[model samples]
Every structure is written in C-alpha cells, then in structure tokens.
Target chain A: MELDFSIEGGDFTQAGQASSRVKKVLKQLGVDAKCIKSIVIALYEAEVNVVAHAYKGQIHIQIDKDKIQTLITDEGPGIPDIAMAMTEGFSTASKKVREMGFGAGMGLPNIKKNTDELKIDSVVGQSTTVSMVNYF
Target chain B: MKVSEIIDQLGLKVIAGEKGLDREISGAYVSDLLSDVMGNAREGQIWITLQVHQNVMAIASLKDLAAVILVKDLEANANTIQHSNEEQIPILSSSLSTFDIAGKLHALLADK
Candidate 1:
C-alpha cells in the first residue's frame, strides 16, 4: 500500500496529522506494536522538520510485505551541512520554534535511531530529501 | 496506576480530555523538549512537562501516552485542549515545578 501527504511549512498546529494517519493505517494493518511506535516517531520528527523549516514538503509512504519506506521531500533553505544537521544538538530553528519545546536538535538523530535504513540529500538554497526504511 | 488516581494523589487539575481519566499509566517521562519525548517516551507513559501547546497533544497522541501533566500551573492553549479532547489523551496541570512534580510522580509510580 502507498500513501502520500502534503505538509504545509510553518504550520505547527497541523504538524503530526500525516504521522497520525499513517499510524492508524499501520495499526489497522496489524503491524507490530513496537514497529509502529518506531515508524510513528521517525515520521513525526520528519513532519515537524518540514513544518519548522521548509517552505512546503511532501511525504510518500510505501508499505510492502517486507518493510515500510518513507520519503520526505521539502523545498526550503536546504541544509548546508547534512553531516552537521545529523548531529544531535545542532539546529537552526528560529526562536519561536524553540519556544514551543522543539528545536532541541534531536529531531534527525531520533529519526536515525528509529529507522533501519536512512539517507539524506540536500542542496543549499534549494531542497532536501530524506528517505528512511524500516524492516518488518 | 490510573491517570485519575495520579491526578487525585498529586493534586493535578484536569485541563482537558476528561474522557481519558481512566487510562492506565505504566510510567512517567519528564521532559520539556519535544524531541526528547518523541524519541524516548513509551506507550502508556505519562509525560510530565512545562510545554503547553497544541504540538504537545500531537506528540502525546502519536506516542500513545496515557496523559500529559503540565508543571508549574501552566495552562494549555485552546488548540491544545481541542486536540486533547479529540485524541482522548488527558491534559493535566499541577502547581508544582518540573522538579517537584517529577520527584513526586516518580515516587508514585515506583510504589506501584
């Protein structure tokens, strides 16, 4: 099965709607409870990244018998250093995003911890694409 | 322990999602950072934090948390309350600071 969701940038109020829907779908499909938790956390952090930093983004989720894959693509001021961005405690979030209890620089690190296979690509001043996969 | 029991014992005020007062609490995770909770908190855990925002509800729901206890008497926003109601994850308030509430909550859950 496949699902796609559009995420609006700077919309903190609606940040996790996509992740919530995907979680329900995973539950209905009888995915393991532990796996569902991992996927939900990873996807949610990705969603928040888009909402907190991107102009806009798209999430594409695909579920197969063997694994679940998520691709998040965002148009924004792309990360100048994917290496630095992947480091925990490194974030460029604005004062407002930080005030909301986010931007602690743990987002990407959390994603990496949850997903089994991860890849991140970015171009300065253009866009970023993150793809993650978790085996069943 | 049930969420309501914690509220009663700790003198917490139910701010929203009254429907979930009976939800069972397995543990407590205290943090003010959204990513910390998102990355580490587990199902059935009661989150103790000072954050009072709509995104907090989103994390609580996605994490399948039993409840959210806001420390220092901080009040959740309208959107936070609305989401709490919709998700049936109770938002609770306490007059104590995070340090006090965390210690109390830890002792309570530990005794269980």
Candidate 2:
C-alpha cells in the first residue's frame, strides 16, 4: 500500500494528522503493536519537524509485506550541518517554537532511535529530504 | 486504575473529553517538552504538563495516551479543548504545580 500527505509549515494545529492516519492503517493491517509504535513515533517527529521548520513539505509512505518506508521532503532553510543537526541538543527552531515545548533538538535523534534505516539529505539554502524504513 | 478514579482522587477538573473518563490508566508520564513526551512516554500513560497548545492533544492522540493533566492551573487553548473533545482523550486540570501534582500522582500510582 502507498500513501501521501501534504504538510503545511507553521501549522502546528495539523501537524500529526498524517501520522495518526497512517497509524490507524497500520493497526488495521495487523502490524505488531511495538512495530506500529516505533513507526508512528518516527513519522510524527518528522511531521512535526516540517511544521516547525519548513516552508512546506510532503510525505510518501510505502508499506509492503515485510517493511514500511517513509520519505519526507521539505522546502525550507535546510540544515547547514546535517551532523550537528542530528545531535540530541542542537536546534535552530525559533523562540516561539521553543515556547510550545518543541525545539528541544530531540526530533531527529528520536527519528533515528525509532527507525531501522534512516537517511537525511539537505541543501543548506533550499530543501531537505528524510527517508526512513523499518522492517516488520 | 481508571482515569475517572484519578480525577476524583486528585480533584482534577475535567476540562474536556469527559467521554474518556472511563479509560484505563496504566501509569503517568510528566513533562512539558513535547518531544520528550513523544520519545519516552508509553501508551496508556497519563501525561502531566503545562503545555496548553493544540499539539498537546495531537501528541496525546497519536501516543494513545490515557489522558492529559494540565498543571499549575493552565488553560488549554480553545482548539486544544476542541481536539480533546473530538479525540475523547480527557483534558484534566489541577491548580497544583507540575512538581506537586507529579509527586501526588506518583504516590497514588505507587500505592496501586
């Protein structure tokens, strides 16, 4: 099965809707509880990152018999240093974003911790794409 | 224990999602950081925090949390209350500070 969702940046109200829908689908597919939890967590973090940082984004999901894959691409002020951005306590989110209890710099690390395979690509001034996969 | 019982015992005001008062409470996770709660909180746990944004409800629903307790008498945003009602995950409130409420809740759960 395949799914796609559009993410509007700065729209925190709608941030996790895509993840929630995907979670329901995974549950109905009889995915294991633990597996679903990890997938949802990673997907949600990525979704929120787009809402928090990007101008806009898109999510693509593919689910097969043995695995699930997610690709989130965003147009924004892309990461200048992917390595530094991946660190647990590093973030460039604005003060308003931080005040809402996000911007703690745990977003990427949480995604990494929950997904089996993770890849991140970014161009400093243009865009970023995050791809992650988990085996069932 | 059930969410309703905690509300009664803790004297937490039910802000919204009264339909979910009967939900089971496995435990509690206390934090104001959205990502921290998302990363570490387990399903069926009640979340204690001061965050009043609508995204708090989003995280609560995605995590399948039992309920959300807003400490220090903080009021959730209008949209947050609306989301809580729609999701049926109760939004509870306490005038006590996060530290105090967390301590009380921890002691109560430990007694169970």
Candidate 3:
C-alpha cells in the first residue's frame, strides 16, 4: 500500500502522531516484525527531525512485499552542515525543543541506522529531503 | 520477570493499561532519547524513561517492549495515552526517579 501523511509543525505535542498511525497500518497489514521495527524507527526519527528542525513537512511512505521507502520533506531551515548534523550529539533545537527531551541530536543518526539506504539533501535556508529505504 | 512483578516490587502506579502487566521482560533500557532506545533496546524489555513523549510509544512498540515505565512521576498528554492504547502498549508511572526504578528492576530481574 502507498501511504502519504502531512505533518503539521504547529505543536510539539503532536509530533509523532503520523508515525504512530503509520505503525498501526503496518501492523494491521501483517508486515514482518523486523521490517516493521526498521520502518518505524527510521520513520519516527525522520518525523522527529521535521518537528525539531523544519517549520513544516510531510512524510511519504510506500510499502510493498520486499521493501519500504519513506521520503520526508521539510520547508524549514535547512542544515548548515549535513556532516555536522549527522553527528550523534549535534543539535540545533531551541531551549523549548531541548526541554521536550528531544533535540539531543540523536534523531538523524537513529534514522540512518535503521534504514538500508539513506540520502539527505539540504541547503541552508532552503529545504531538506531525507529519503530512507529498508529492504526486507 | 513479568512486568507485574517489577511494578509490584517498585510500587508503581499504572497510569493506563493496567491489565497488561502480565507481560514478561527479561531486561531493561532506560533513556530519555527515543533514538537511543530504538538503536539499543532489545525485545522483551522494559523501557524506563523520564521522556513522556508520543515517540516513546512508537519506539517501544517498534521494539515490542514488554512495558514502558515513566520514572520521576512525569506525565504524558492524552495523545500519548491514546496512541499507546491503540497499540496495546502499557505505560506505568512511578514515584521513584529513573535511577531508583532501574536499580530496582535490574536487581529484581537479575537474581531470577
């Protein structure tokens, strides 16, 4: 099934809702446990990124028999340094995001870990597109 | 050990989904970072965290954690509880801090 979700950056409280819904759909579809874990982790980390860094974004999820692809796009402040952003402890969130127990700089790294193929394209002050693919 | 055993031992209060305590957890992972938990947590484990975010539910569900125990008496919003309910994920609250709860759970499960 091909699933698409629009994520609003209005409230931090609602940040992970889309990922949760995606998880439920994947579960009801009887996706493999390992594949489900991989997709959830990757998708959630990406979702966290959009909430933490971008002003707004959307998550596009496509699932088939052997693989899942997720494209998360954001129209917020892009990364100044993709290399630095990928570092485990580097974060750009304000005091508020930090207070929420996120913005600790683990989001991107976690997404990268869970997927088999990952790509990030960003330009400072433009936008970012993060693509992740997990093969079963 | 079963999650109920840990709860009883620590005197935890179930904020939601009390009936699922019969779940078993062989180990524990404590972290406020959902990413770290996702990267490190193993199956059949209990996650003790101070972070009361919806992502905690996502990470726990992905890992198939036996239960999630929020230490320091922190509270999550309705959305968190709602998502957890749909996923059938049990989230408990404890008056103890993360350190105390982790110690108690680790010691309780270790000897067995």
Candidate 4:
C-alpha cells in the first residue's frame, strides 16, 4: 500500500503527518517494532528536510511486505553539493530556521543512516529528489 | 520517580501528555542533532535538547522515549505537544538549561 502527504514549507503543523501515518500502517501490517522505528526515523528526517529546506513539497511513501520507501522531491533552490550536504554539522538554513532545532545538517545524513538505500539528485536552480528505503 | 516530583524538583511544566509525566525516564540524551537522537535515544529516556520541532516528537516515538524536554526556555508549540500526546510521550518544557537538567537528573538517579 502507499500513502502521500503534502508537507508545506515553514508549516510546522503538518511536519510529521506522513511519518505518523506510515508508523500507524506499519503497526497494522504487523511489521516489527524495530523495523518500524527505523522507517519512522528516516522518513521523519527526510520529511523535516523538505519542510526546512524546500519551497514546499510532498512525500511519497510506499510500503510492502518486504520494505518501505520514501521518495521526497521538492521544488526549491536545489542543493549544489550532495556530498557537503551529507556531512554532519553542515547546514545552510537561516538563523530563524536554526532556532527551531533543525538545519544542523543532520537531515540527509540521518536518512542515509537509517535506510538501507539512499539516492539523491539535484540542481542549483531547479529541484531536489531524495529516495530512501528501509527493508523489513 | 514520578513525573510530579520531577516537575517539582526541576520547576518544569507538562505542556501536554499529562498522563505520561508520572512515567519514569531511564537515560536522557543531550543533543540538538536529530540524527544522533534517532539511534542513541533508548526507551524511557527523557530527551533533553534545545530543539523544537514536530519531527522531534516523531523521533522520540521511534526511540520509545518516555518524554521530551525542551531545555533553556525553548517552547514546544501546540502541534508538537499534540504529536507527543498521540505518540504517548510526555512533552515537557523547562526553564533550566540542558546542562542543569542533565546535572540534576544525573545526580538524582545516580544513587538509584
């Protein structure tokens, strides 16, 4: 099954809606709690990344008997260096955003750590797409 | 220790999830990095951080944490509280800095 939720940039209200829904689905599917936790963390991190960095976007979540995948594509000022952005403690968010306890440069890295697979594609003026999957 | 005593000893407020305050916390982590928190936080630990976001509650839930405390007078808004409630995690706000909360919590639990 699949679930999709639009995460509005600068809108903290809807920040974890997608992850919450996914968590519920995994529980109902009888997925292991440990695996469910991993998916929740990775999806939550990626969702926060889109909300904190992008110009507003949607998270596409797909779940099956084997694994869970979260594809986050955003239309915003794309990241120039995926390598740099993946580094811990590297961030480009504004001071106000930083005050909210995000943009510490851990978003991408966290997604990478929790998921079994991670892929990224981006451009400076166009958009960014982040794909991650966690296997059961 | 009950949540009431922790609140009394530390001068903290239960922003939401009142049902969970009485729950005990085993170990608490002090980090603003959400990534570190995802793997490091264990069950029943009070996550003491200066960060405030809806995702924080999500991370705490994944860790099976007992509660989340925003140190140094940071505010955890309505949505954050509501999310914590749904996750069955107590969302707490403390005027004490992260350092102080860590120290106090450590001292209080060290003997036990």
Top candidate (TM-score): 2
The CAPRI classification for model 4 reads as medium
lDDT of each: 0.94, 0.95, 0.80, 0.79
**DockQ-better candidate, 1 vs 2:** 2
lDDT of 1 at B16: 98
Clashes of 4: 0
Q: What DockQ does candidate 1 score?
A: 0.94
Clash pairs, model 4 backbone: none
- The candidate 4 chain B region of ten consecutive residues with least summed lDDT is B1-10
**In model 2, what lDDT does residue B37 have?**
96
Candidate 1 chain B minimal-lDDT segment of 10 residues: B1-10
True contacts kept of each: 0.97, 0.97, 0.56, 0.56
Q: Which residues of candidate 3, in runs, are more than 4 Å off?
A: A25-30
**lDDT of candidate 3 at residue B90, scale 0 to 100:** 84
Task: List clashing residue pairs in candidate 3.
Answer: none
In DockQ, how does model 4 score against the reference complex? 0.54
Q: What is the per-residue lDDT of model 1 for residues B22-97, given as tens digits with 9 covering 90 to 100?
A: 9999898988899999999988999998898899999999998999999888989999999999999999999999
Q: What would the per-residue lDDT of candidate 4 be over residues B31-110, giving only the tens digit for each residue?
A: 88776787567777888888777778877876778788888788886777888787767888888888889898778767
lDDT of 3 at A90: 93
Model 4 sits at an interface RMSD, in angstroms, of 2.4
Residue A96 displacement (Å), model 4: 1.2
